[model samples]
Target: MTPRADPLTVDVVDLIGTVVVRFHEEYEHAAAEHSLTGAQARLLSLLAVEPLPMRRLAQRLKCEPSNVTGIVDRLESRGLVERRPDPDDRRVKLAAPTAEGARTAERLRASLDFAREPLGQLTVAERTLLKQLLQRMLGITPEPSQNPEQEEKKGGKGEKKREQGE
Candidate 1:
């Protein structure tokens, strides 16, 4: 019989941590020419993809909504973002990237391709295998989690709801 790999021998968490650090380092360098902070670049990119409510954006960014307001304000001052009234609820504001903001995000992304070159060294087959293996081991592809607004929309069980009398 073939020898079994020891489950305890694998340090997958450390490997993932290293990968994230390296990726961010490369990203910081790539976007340096744009003079945008990492957070700014990330926020711009998010808004470019789709307009999101302030609360939702804050949640996605893992920060307080008030903090998101400041970010949005800065971006707006730079003419990179614009806010509009939500269709369903005028009281709610939706944030979207302007054309200039989209362009900035695209430029940042193009520059960031330098970070992918190392991955290109792997053969297509190896890359595919690695991706599949990692996915299988993790049971999910890593990505950002839902924002508080999204949780609210999902009817968060733990969230308090106002009673009619209260």
Candidate 2:
């Protein structure tokens, strides 16, 4: 058997786990209200920002390519998403959300206000501090503010771009 952890460490880990579980439950309820399974809802959300190829979707969802194909097939049947030939490679197919899909995904997001109720309890300063603390815990170093237009012009290399195969 493993040795017992410190009481403070155990409490912190338990709290984080509980918060994550609650958030997932809330998200599931929001998805169900739209008549979407969790996977389908997640796929729609992923495609909302930009079209992605099947392989890329699998990578993002941490699932097998075959699994993504099945999910895409179902979403396509619902007319929420469509498969298009990639511009860079005709052989590759990209999954893109249709107009209806985008609206549905937006609605699903709007319904999930789980964080709003609790986070609203904190003052602005407290919220800011909480965000900073969370970021630090995730090992993300805060960057100095930069001009949004400049960042856009630079193409934000740090952000993932959809590649032909990926």
Best by lDDT: 2
Off by over 4 Å in 1: 1-10, 125-166
Candidates' lDDT values, in order?
A: 0.75, 0.84
Q: Please list the residue runs of candidate 2 whose C-alpha ends up more than 4 Å from where it truly belongs after superposition.
A: 1-4, 139-143, 146-166
- Please, what are the lDDT tens digits per residue for candidate 1 over residues 1-166? 9786566645666667888898888777765678777777778888888999988888888889888899889889999999999989999889999999999988888787644676555544444467667777879764454344454456433333322223
Per-residue lDDT of 108 in model 1:
84
The lDDT, on a scale of 0 to 1, for candidate 2 is 0.84
**Global Cα RMSD, each model:** 16.3, 10.5
Pairs in clash, predicted candidate 1: none
Task: Say which candidate scores most in TM-score.
Answer: 2
lDDT of 2 by residue, 1-166 (tens): 9989999999999998998999899989999999998889999999999999999999999999999999999989999999999999999999999999999999998898888778655544455567667888999875554334344346533232322223
